[model samples]
Target: MKLTKEERIRLTYQIGDIIEQKCRRCYYNRSDDASFSINICAKCPTGQTLRQLGRYFDTEPRSRGGKTGNMPDGLTPARVRELNDQGIPDKEISIMFERSPSYVGKVKNRWRKHRVMARAESGAEEVK
Candidate 1:
C-alpha cells in the first residue's frame, strides 16, 4: 500500500484540486497577497478537507468563528454507511450529526477499504 514519491505528489495535487473546486462552490474568498487570508466557513467541505489534509494553518481566521469541539457521540461507521445508502450526501450527513464533513468522508473511506479487503479475501478463498 506504500505509494512512490511521484504517486504521492500526484495524489496530493488531485486532492488539492478537489478541495479548491469545493471551496469555489462554497464561496470561499481568496486573497492575492501572501499575507492575505482565505476566508471559509468552518463547516464547509473544503475547510474540513483542508484541515484533514493538514493544509490549513492555525493562524488563519475562520469566517464561522471556531470549532465547537463537540464530538458526535452516537455516530458509528455502520450509521454513516446507512445514511449514505439512504442517499444522504456526506455534507448533509455531517450537518445532521453535528460533525465535520471530513469525518464523514473518512468513515465512508474506511468502510470502502473494508469492503475492498473483504472482497479480496473472498476472491482468494474462491481461488483456493
Candidate 2:
C-alpha cells in the first residue's frame, strides 16, 4: 500500500492546507460521533506551550536565557507514537527523540491507562 510520489505530494499539500487554515476547530466542532483524525493540540501557537515543548525538539543548545536546545527532532506526538510502536526503551527513546525519559514514561503511562479504560468500556476483560 505504498503511495506513488504524486499521491504523497498531493497528501502533503492537502495536510498543509488544512493546517494553514487552522482546522482544529472543525474537527472538535463536528456533531457526528465518528472520530476525527487526531492533530496538534488546540493550544497551538502559544509561546508558553511551545516553550514547554522545548525539551522535545532537537533544536539548538539552550542559552542561559532559557531557549530551546538544538534538538532537531523537536518533539511531536507522531514521533512519540513511532517510538512506542517500535518498542524502543523509554530511556533510549528519550535520547533519540530529544525528550526527557520521565516525560516519555509519563506519555507511555497515560496511553496505557487510556487503552485499559477503552477496553473496559468496550466490555473486554483482561485475562490474568
Candidate 3:
C-alpha cells in the first residue's frame, strides 16, 4: 500500500524508536550491512524504509510480549519443594522450571528456614 508523506514520516519515527529501544543494544553488530548501523538521534532512512515496506530487520522475533525472564507458568513454590524432595538437583529444577539455579536454591533455603521456624514454634507450644 502507498503511504502518504505524513504517514511515511510517522512510520519512520516509529521504526527508529523500535531500533533505538530494542535493536541498538542487541542487534547493532548483527547486520552485515555496515551502512545500517543504528544511531538513536540520527534518521536511518534505509532501515526505516525497509521496515515501512513490511520487512523486519530486528534480531529477535516479535512475539507475545517477548521473553519472560521469570519462572515458567505452573511452577509454584510447592512444586519446587516437591522436586527437591524427590532428589532433583537445583540446576535440574531450574531447567525444568525455566528459572535460574540461584532462584531454586533460594526457594529451597527459604522453605528450609520456614520449616525450622515452624518446628521451633511447635516445640515451644508443647513445652507450655
Task: Estimate the TM-score for candidate 2.
Answer: 0.25
Better of 1 and 2 by lDDT: 1
Query: What is candidate 3's local distance difference test score?
Result: 0.57
Order of all candidates by lDDT, from best down to worst? Answer: 1, 3, 2
> Judged by TM-score, which candidate is best?
1
- Which residue runs does candidate 1 get wrong by more than 4 Å? 1-71, 111-128
Assess each prediction's global lDDT (C-alpha) against the native.
0.59, 0.53, 0.57
State which candidate, 2 or 3, has the greater lDDT: 3
Give the candidate number with the greatest lDDT.
Answer: 1
Q: Provide the global lDDT of candidate 2 against the true structure.
A: 0.53
1-128: candidate 2 lDDT, tens digit per residue: 45567866776675555544544344444534433453455555532343444333434555674343333354434455556679876788777766676766765565466674345345565311
Expressed as tens digits, the lDDT of each residue in 1-128 for candidate 3 is 45667876777777666666565554434554443565433245444554544443333565885345454665555565467679998899887767676767875565466564344334432110
- Cα deviation at 81, candidate 2, in Å, is 7.5
What residue runs in model 3 are displaced by over 4 Å at the alpha carbon? 1-69, 110-128
